[model samples]
Target chain A: MASPEIEELTQALSRLPGLGPRSARRAVLHLLKKRESALEPLLRALDAVNERLVTCSLCGNVDTVDPCGICADPRRDARALCVVEDVADLWALDKSRLFPGRFHVLGGRLSALEGVRPEDLSIDALVARVEAGGIDEVVLAMNATLEGQTTAHYLAERLERFPVRLTQLAHGVPVGGELDYLDEGTLAQALRARRPLG
Target chain B: MASPEIEELTQALSRLPGLGPRSARRAVLHLLKKRESALEPLLRALDAVNERLVTCSLCGNVDTVDPCGICADPRRDARALCVVEDVADLWALDKSRLFPGRFHVLGGRLSALEGVRPEDLSIDALVARVEAGGIDEVVLAMNATLEGQTTAHYLAERLERFPVRLTQLAHGVPVGGELDYLDEGTLAQALRARRPLG
Candidate 1:
């Protein structure tokens, strides 16, 4: 019932991660209604990102620059490298500001179900980075999912020959998590890795 | 931790309906990963819609051409005018193919809380269209909500002087609705407007 351009716009929007057909239509309507405030800004932003954005050759992270801001920053701890399944995970970890290190995006996890292998990821590059030598620690910051853990374990074996220390994120109850709501595996991990009081 | 362009893109996406900050970030990452297939197509589609889309001066419906497809269509019943609160509603109604007529978008409902008056909508233009003649029926296809009903009532009053038959959508149970799950208001409406068996 809408114009072809509007329908096409809605179809494109629905392909995004969070938006479905219904929501995409609503979003398109909203954009059409507020062309100056919403549509134009979004268009400009998308255009800018599309024109300027580039993948970091060193770590596989996407940014406006070749090496990315994180990789080029002199203040970040180059010795501590964080390996992640995807750029989104890298962004999430970096947003915390707790890991004062650079990142290596694996591009994807080792998914046996989907037939994703180590060869498909940037595993060779990660090993080469560790072997080339300034890195003292390699944090495998993959998600706690089965595939993520499997990838981390595989990476550990590959990087074990190197002089760098290998580690993964600890499994525990979340900060504001209720004990009753906590799952068995998490509670067990949290209890088993109990820390000493200051 | 993302680049400024990427950050701007995420912020713009988050402003869209049904998309929040986290989802927007995920969407941006998805776009970055699939630049060729997803991002480029979306950009092209948005650009096309932005550049070519125009609102129909007569009815406020948006299209690639002036007067819109519905308003310009020779096959459509020009004598039957479907009045809607928004273009989205117009599209929805038209999608059903039940309303074989042209439409007039009121822009928004008459919401006293939001300070939206009749003057703010396309009510004056609607009245002018009716006064110009040839319209036999004016279907007030507003939503069943309080505000929608109020807007329909206001439009009915304004168009009462015209020879056109002013009508509204029936208030009752939906096509596949169950009595157990239905609200009291809907149930009462369904009972009041119940039709005899064939």
Candidate 2:
């Protein structure tokens, strides 16, 4: 019923995460209605990102610059390196303003089912960065998933010979979580890793 | 944590309907990761739609052409016209392929609460089209909302003197609707307009 161009636009929008065909159509209509405000700005932003964005050589994070803003920032603690399964994870951690350190994106977790091996990830680069020596701590901030834990274990074994101290994010009940609603595994982990109140 | 350009992109994406900040961030990450397959195609589609799409002067429908594909088609029943509240509604009705007639978009319904008046819509243009003659029936396919009904009544009064026959969509229980789950208003309408056995 819509023009081919409009249909194509809707199809393209539906490819985005969390947006289905019905909502994509609505979004397209909204874009068409507010062409100057929504459509034009989005176009400009996409063009700028597509043209200027590049993956960091030192870390796998994406940024407008090659080294990335986080990697190049002198204020960050260069001694502490955070290893994550993906750039999204890196962004999520950095957005909190905690974790005052540089990041190394592992590209993906080690998944035996999916055939994702150690070489498929940026594990070699991570080890090389740790081996180069100034990093005092390597924090494995991989997700709590089984594959993520496997990847962290593999990285720890490879970096054990290095001078850097290895650590991983603690598994426990989340902040503001209700005890009744949490899974049994989380409850057990929280109990095992209990800390004394200050 | 993200570059200025990526942040701007996420902000722009968040402006879309049905998408919030977190989902928009995820969408941006997906786009950046699949730049060749997803991002470029979306950009190209948006650019094409922005450059070529236009609202039909005759029917108020949006398309790449002046009269729109429906209006330009000689196979459509020009004698029967379907009046809708918005272009989206027109596209939706047309997508079903159930409405064989051409459509006239009123841009929006008459909402006194929202300060939307008859003059604010394409009512005058619609009246002009009906006055041009040859139309036999005008289907008032407005939404079931109070504002939509009010607009339909106003349009009916305006087009009363025209040679065209005015009609409206039948109000009743929707297809596949269970009586237990339906609202009182719909149940009443369905009972009142209940069809006799063949």
Candidate 3:
């Protein structure tokens, strides 16, 4: 009989972005071996995140509290908004320390094949936030994929009439680059977004 | 002014194998996003493991309870012992289901420069267990590193006086191949251990 515990562990690990069955098995074995030092802490971290972390009500980024540390911080620039595909992308941009603005996590891009539409993203909420008046510029940091481009275009059209400036994160994002692969999509977007830099 | 919480998290994550500062940051971000899905469960698992796990007095393998299941199981063959460098090696052997014997975890190899002497390993205990009688074989499954080889040679010599059979894991470990890199080192060992197909 296949042990359900192992099967569950394998399945759980396999769901990770890069891990597969073999790697999952290896990781599980590592945990089993170093139970006290490695496994215990990992499990604790997992539980803590599950029990305590909440999504920011405004931007959809994860945080220990609603609205997240970034969104809640009054020191951050409210006039600028950085849009990202996922929480991981937000973190990537955060590490660069280039953006003092708040973030909006779209969760994913607009994909016809995947049935992900603009409504499927956080764009509607983003548009509403922008129309509320304080946000001076909305930077489209969505990926360069077909779906990302489509989502960005949709958002651009929706935000066109707003008093705020509408700008797409620029050409620095490689043809196939994902936000995870780009360091500070904010800075790259800023440089490429400069007026008449051409 | 370092936030103690950030410090705690950073230190905890850095302790994980292969996780450097960059990886740890990325991991923390990822955990923050999927807090409920991964973080909470991981935290609970960690606490459970830490609170419940203990080292097997016999083999030094980690388990939720003392005298780990393998060591307590009467069905296992005590006569045939598998000597491995780390508990991870023990798990690999167990997963293969090829060896029904008990195990001895050396904790680490004999690295003279690293000051890991023979006594530092559980070699003495292994020798004592073998000398106590009833043991049919002692298979040295230490890593194929220079230190591992040195340790194995030392064990082979120490156990030579005993009536028990003395054998190693059999080489052909593909020089640079780490134990984790091998799908199943037990299988690889068995194959390399085979004496002429004929």
Candidate 4:
């Protein structure tokens, strides 16, 4: 029988994205075997992250300090705000190494089908911040999913009254992304959303 | 520019199985966003596992203390032994809820191609323990890989000199393992290894 402690470790590891019971077991076994090499470093990193980490009060992103380095920086464009559904979306945009403005993370998209409503999102804060007048542009950098579109449209409607330019992400096809690799809907939408200059 | 701290965190996360730069970024972002609810718990679990965990000095399996509960327990068969390549192998055997005797982890299999020799393993200790004479049988339960087979054969030959019974794990379709579902190689192996019961 597996010890309760080992079981707990496995369960905890399984909670990570893409990790299942089998993979979790394999990972734990690997960790146990290389306890000094991998596990100790992992443990130390975990503790360090936990003890020092905080959140960006403005964008709801994780950081080691409140407001985060991005939000606190004086040189960043306070006038340009990129709105994304989740912190993943924010990181995706950041990886482009193009955007120089601040971000607003909504945590998740509006999904009436899933009962996620407008009020459940951080849209109110975004609207208030937009009305505060420093923001000149608001880019909806959400995933091109059904819910993502719904949320973007909803936010667009709300921001119509506020004085801010709106835009969306456009560029090369993702590096490892494929057409057959993409679903029918996403492929069709990507084609339809194709722009000139590329 | 991203902070060195954030970069370091991302690098550490990248080392985890299946996590690359993109996945690592997403995970770090998620951890930051759910700092209190998810990240803190993960950090605590990692810390606790590292600080409190130990390995069984005798069997080399991970545990909360040296010798492990299994090795320290008075009821387990100290006389009979089961040999395996990795601690994971031992855990898998344990999961069967069978195998009453204690275990001996060889750390890994012997592979001339990989420069692994018997002397590189715990073979010396295993031989000494077997020679001490209480052991009636030693089961060679190493993996079914080529290296594992070689290790098993070598150990069997070495231990043949001692006054102890030695045997290898039966080669056949695994229990809950199907023939048609088996790959061509495994199917061929199952056929080749067929035996008649007396």
Predicted structure with the largest DockQ when compared to the true one: 1
- For each candidate, give its TM-score against the true structure: 0.95, 0.91, 0.74, 0.88
What number of clashing residue pairs does each candidate have, in the order they appear? 0, 0, 17, 1
Better of 1 and 3 by TM-score: 1
True contacts kept of each: 0.91, 0.91, 0.19, 0.29
- What is the docking quality class of candidate 1? high
Clashing pairs in 2: none
Tens digits of per-residue lDDT, candidate 1, B1-198, equal: 778898999999999999999999999999999999899999999999999999999899998888788999999999999999999999889999998889999999999999999999999999999999999999999999999999998998999998999988898888998999999999999999989999
Weakest ten-residue segment in model 3 chain B by summed lDDT? B1-10
- Give the range of the ten consecutive residues with the poorest summed lDDT in model 4 chain B: B1-10
- Tell me the spans in candidate 3 whose CA falls farther than 4 Å from its real position: A1-14, A19-48, A75-77, A92-100, A113-115, A144-147, A170-198, B1-11, B112-115, B170-198
Task: Choose the strongest candidate by TM-score.
Answer: 1
Candidate 4 per-residue lDDT over residues B49-124, each given as its tens digit: 7777786767777778788877887888887899999877887898886888888889889997888888888888
lDDT of 2 by residue, A35-101 (tens): 9999999999999999999999999999888788898999999999999998889988998989999
Greater-lDDT candidate between 3 and 4: 4
Greater DockQ among 2 and 3 belongs to 2
Off by over 4 Å in 2: A112-115, A173-181, B112-115, B176-181
Candidates, DockQ = 0.85, 0.81, 0.21, 0.42
Residue pairs of candidate 1 with colliding backbone atoms: none
**Which residue segments of model 1 deviate by more than 4 Å?**
none
User: How accurate locally is residue A180 in candidate 4, as Cα lDDT from 0 to 100?
Assistant: 67
